[model samples]
Target: MSLWYFLIDWFAGVPTFGVLFKRFMINFAWVCIALFVMLVFQLPAEYAAIVYFGFIVVNGVMGFVFLRQRMQMRD
Candidate 1:
């Protein structure tokens, strides 16, 4: 409904605002987690960003592995 929300929905091709809201929540959670770790551990905040970015890639691999393992178990 709002301008920025409209732009995001249009750009993402999502028909409902709920979908956009869900995606934003997930992304924001990851960012919060990264920043929290950085602050609590006294590590460089940049590495937190780097690690969060890496989460995208490693998540795919882990998902694939879990899927494959489940498929194999069914046989």
Candidate 2:
């Protein structure tokens, strides 16, 4: 299914909390794996922090988009 549809459905309570949490953990697992590899390779601390910061920014944008979509649907 489309990304927008998936997010909208999740926000609308179509999926149970367990399912959503599981999905989040699964996706986050990959991010953790990538970070681990970067650490193992001895990447510079400043670069590593930038990667983490990017993740935080993306997460904030996703939250904003989800909230905006939900609000639009309400109107």
Per-candidate clash tally: 0, 0
Candidate 2 lDDT over 1-75, as tens digits, reads: 899998566445423445545545654676688789999998888877877776666555555555665677789
lDDT of 1: 0.62
Candidate 1 Cα outliers beyond 4 Å, as residue runs: 1-13, 45-75
The residue ranges of model 2 lying beyond 4 angstroms of the native Cα positions read 1-27
Backbone clash pairs for candidate 1 read: none
lDDT of 1 by residue, 1-75 (tens): 799996444344433446545655666687788778788989986787687776665445444554565567679
Q: Against the hidden reference, what TM-scores do the models get?
A: 0.40, 0.63
Against the true structure, whose TM-score is highest?
Answer: 2
State the C-alpha lDDT per candidate.
0.62, 0.64
Candidate 2 global Cα RMSD: 4.7
Show the lowest summed lDDT stretch of 10 residues, model 1.
7-16
